[model samples]
Structures are given as C-alpha cells and as structure tokens.
Target: MKVLHVITGLGVGGAEQQLRLLLRHLPARCEVVTLTHPGPVADGLRADGVPVVHLGMTGNRDLSALPRLTRLVRAGRYDLVHTHLYRACLYGRLAARLAGVRAVVATEHSLGETQTEGRPLTAGVRALYLAGERLGSTTVAVSPTVAARLRRWGVPASRIEVVPNGIDLARFRFDPVRRHRTRRRLGLPDDAFVVGGIGRLVPGKRFDVLVRALARLPGDCRLLLVGGGPDEHVLRREARRAGVADRVLLTGERPGLPDGSPGPDLPSLACAMDVLASPSPEEAFGLAAVEGLASGLPVLYAACPALEDLPPHTAPAARRVPCGDEEFGRALAEVRAAGPGPRTAPEAARHYCITRSAARLMDVYATALARQSLSPAPQGVSSA
Candidate 1:
C-alpha cells in the first residue's frame, strides 16, 4: 500500500523520531512521503531508498503548497496519508481529502493545549486544529494521556486511537566498552558523576532548571545537554548566569537520521550519565526518559501526567521532580545517591522498540481500512 507520512519538521524531536522508526520498519511494499522541515530526516529517508517530497513549506498556512500536495497525492493514488504533529495533521489531511485518498490518519504527539514558551496557540488556533482533525479517518495519540487530552478537547472518540511511540533496540542497545571510550574521549574524569539530558533546547524543556539544580549538587557532578534548537543560545546564557557553564556541555546537533546512524551511539552517550534528568514541565511521551532507562540509568522526570505512566521498566527506574529548582535538586540527589537497578538495555528495549511499536501501528492502519469499508463517510464531508 502507498502510505505518505507527514510531519511538522524533521528536527530532532519525539515526533520525528517516532516517524523515523515507523518508516524504517514499514513493509517493503509501502511507500512514504514527507512534508515539513525536510532536512536531516529527508536525507536519511533517501539513504534508505525511500522517496520523500519536501514541498518547501515555510509554515502551516502554505496554501500554495496545498494544490501541489493534492496533485501529488492524487497522482500517487495513495491508500493512506498518515500525519504526525499539528501542522502536518491540519494541512496534510486536508490535502489528502482533496486528492480523494480513502484514509487519512493523524498521531497527536503532544497535548493540544500545552504551550512551550513563546509557542502557545490561542483558543482560536486550537479550535481550528480540532476542526481540521475531525476530517481524519483515524486519529492516534502516542500515549493514553495524549489520547484522553484530545477527547477532553472534543475530538470525536470514534476516530481516536492510542498508539505508543517506539525505538530501535539495536541502535539504542547498551555497550559497556563504547560507553567507556566515549567518556574518555570527552575527558570526563573517571570519578566524576554525569547527569545527562537529551531534548530540543527549548524553553519548555527546562534545561535551565537542570543547570540550576546541578549547582545545588556536589561540585563533582556535571551536566550533558544533548540535541539542538532555537533556544540553545538562551539556555547557554542561563547556564552562564547560574555559574554552571563550565559544567554544562551542549552537544549541538548530531548526525543520525530516521535512516542515518542512530545519532551518536547510544552506549557512548549513555555511559556519560549516572542519571538522566528531564526537567520539562510537559511531555507527551518521554522518549528520552525511556532511552535513559534502556541505558540502565535512573531518570528524574518532572512530575507530570504525561510522564507518570512510563512503560513498565521505566516507571520503576525513574523518579519525578516538581518543577521548582529545589524540588528538582532534591529529586536529582535522591536518585543519584540510589543507584539504578539491574535493568539492562535489552530488558528496557522490550518496552519501546520500534519494531514492536510498528506492528501495533499496522494493526491500527488495517483496522481503519476495515472500518472505512463498512461505514458511510461523515455527512457534509467534501473532497473539494
């Protein structure tokens, strides 16, 4: 079947990672198309022999691209168009309908109302999002929290499905030797403790809070902030202001793709941390937290509903910290003093493997097709 996957961007974020994993494992007969910030992920898809169309979309309201996207979908005769993130969900699904696609599916990657600093949507925008998604043949959420949130916001229950995100076990598998080498290469002292975090350097990620909390810890403790985004400079300044600049390492952007290498080796990165810190006040599904757990490290995640129901291995392996600096510091110290359990990478991989998650997604896709065949299209729905 021809399946087109749409996303807001190919940036280093949870939704991108989820789409990457799905594309990698999708059946060979399936075809994929991407429309968003077609950067690294697009390159990676081509590397895997998957065809990707960028569309040069500058923002969500790129009406000019609509005709192009509609034409492409119609020409491809795609059986399904599965969209990830808000922008693609809005634009891609609409375009898919215009092209006479039988199925349009969307995965809600974040809570609809939650705003990450400077990016909160007004009530009007949120309403528009809800209205657009109503056109989707199926709506998916990466976690139950996200699914429930959409329902609460008035998304039709009949169209919503909850599907958790998945990771690649082989890529994220633990490697003791690689971890040792990576630590040595970074010049980390054998005796020093590393508290690591991986996420977009955004205001909502609260990396500044992690930096401040590190100041409260013993001097022997250091911080590693991985990934990149617009807020990198803002976060760097905050670290300097908090007097922990030297202790914080921003690894910038790394080379790896949904089809490229799995962003520097997980073992090497995981070895640099005694504990993984997540200070974000909101998370739809904590991929970083799960990755930390897969690496056999304890995670200190913010006390938020999105993170509270981490998969089996993760729930036991992570501790939750309140958003305040003092609470974060206390949570960090407590997790640090107590070591991680005997969970190995292989053990943790079972809960979030991309292969496992893909199978579940396939079931969702097939179910949508079956339901569509049996039911009439909602009244007043127009392909135009």
Candidate 2:
C-alpha cells in the first residue's frame, strides 16, 4: 500500500529518529512530508531513496500550507496518511480528510502525565489536540502509560493503540573491542568510572541533577551528556556552578552515518561506559535506558513507565531511583558495589526489535483499511 508520513520536523529527536528507523523495516511504499526544519534525518531518508517534501510552513499560524498539503495528498493518491508529533497530527489529519483519504492514523510519541513537550498541558492545548485527534482513524501510543494518559485526556479507549518504540538490537549488541575503541576515540581514561545520559538537553531531562550527582560521587567518576538542544549552555553553566565542569563531557548532536544506516552505533558509546543514567521525570518511553540494557550495562532511571510496565525478566538490570542528586548518587554507589550483575542484555532487548514493531504497525494499518472498507464515504466531499 502507498503511505505518506507527516511530521513536524526531521530534527534528531526521539520521534524523528524512531520514524527513520521504522521506515527501514516497513514494507509499504512510503514517502515523507516535513512541515519545517528538514534537518539531518531528512538527508538520511533521501539517501535511503525515500522522497521527502518540505512544506515551508513559516509558523504554526501559517494556514496557507493547508491547501498545498491537501493538494499533495490528493496528487500522490496515497492509500494511508500517518501523522507523528503534535503539529503534524493537527494539520495532517485535516489535510488528509480534505484530500478524501479515509485511512488516517497518528502516533503520540512524546506525551507524559503533566507535560506535552517539557511544558505544562494547558486547557487550550488539550482542546486543540483533542480536536485534531478526532479527525484520525486511530492513535498509536508509544507506551501503556501514554495510552492511559490519552484516555484520561478524553480520547476513547478503543481509539488508542499501544505500540512500544523499538531499537535495532544488532547495532547495539555488546562488543568489548568496539567499547575499547570508542573509549579511546572519546579520550576517556580506561579505568575511569563513566556514567552516561543520552537525550536532548532540555529542562525536563534534568541533566543538572546528573551533573550534581557526578559531583557527589568519588574523584574517579565522570559524566557524559549526549545529544544537544537549546539548554546546552545552561547545562554547561550548571556543570561549572557545581564545580564538576572538568568531569562533565558534552558531545553536541552527532550526525547519522552518511550511508543511511539504521543507527549511529549508540551501543558503542553505551559499552564504553560503566553505567547509564536517565533522570528524566517525564519520559514516554525510555529508549536510551533500553539500549543501555541491551549493551550489558546497569541502568539507573528516575521515571520510566515503559520499563516498569514490562515484565521483570525483560529488563532485570534497570533500577528505579528517586529524582534527586543524593538519591541518584546513592543508587550509583550501590550499583558500582554490586558490579554488572547478570548478562541479561540480549534477552531484555529481544521483545523490542525494530522488525517486530514494524510487523505490529502493519497490523494496525491493515485493521484501519479493513474498517474503512466497511464504511461508506460521505456524499458531497470535495478535495481541497
């Protein structure tokens, strides 16, 4: 089937990266439309031979792009239009309906209990999101906790589908040789105790807490902050203020490989470290934590509903801790004292492979198509 994916932007965030990975495994004839900021991910998709159209949406209030998007949808003759992120969900649903496409689906990849994207969920935002949600056939939630949150926000339980975010396990598998190589490339000492955190440098991620925790640890410990965002300067200032700037290493956003590979060898970075820490209190799905587990490292996270929802056998190496510097430091000490524990990385990541996620998504697509076949199109509908 012909499918078109609509997203807010193609920046190097969780949702954007997940979409790039999903396209690698999906069988449908797929194309992409980015509303704005067609960044590195866009280049990677094009290198992989996927057509990407950039709609130069000046801002959120640029309604003129609606007709342009609708025209593109009609011209493409797509059987399905799937939307990701907030702005795309809002405009893509409307555009798909205008183009007379009946099979439209959206994925909610970044919603938490109290925040949408590091901001409080105001009433106006909820109303707008709910209005957009009504135009789609189904909404895919990335986790059970997010599904529950959608229901609480007034979305019908029947309309929500829980599909966990997946990782390419082969790319993240543990390799001692690669681990040593990565450590040397990053200029890290062989015997240093490294604690790594991966995510956009946003306020909600709480990287400052991690910096403070590093200060509270012993002299040989260090912090590695991966990914970049608006708060990079703020985090650097925080590290300096905490007197741990010397121990904190920040690698600003790394580009994907030029060959359009599925991953950036994140597992190599994870393997180079002794432990992984995720202190974000508003995670929809802890992708980094899962990758760390798959890399055979103990993970300490503050809030990961996805990990908690899974069976104990799935990720036995993940431990939950309170959200504070002292608690995080204490947990780190305990984990270091206990050593690496068991080698459950491969088993823990078995359930979250990208191939499995792609099959489940195809199932969702088939279900939507079947439901559409049973319903009659409304009369007097016109393409915009």
Best by TM-score: 2
Per-residue accuracy of model 1 over 31-79 as CA lDDT, tens digit each: 4555666766566666767787777776656688778888888888777
Q: Return the lDDT, model 1, position 122.
A: 71
lDDT, candidate 2, at 59: 90
Candidate 2 on 110-153: residue-level lDDT in tens?
89878886757899999999988887888999889999999999
* Candidate 1 TM-score versus the reference: 0.92
lDDT of 1: 0.74
Q: What is the C-alpha lDDT of each candidate?
A: 0.74, 0.86
lDDT of 2: 0.86
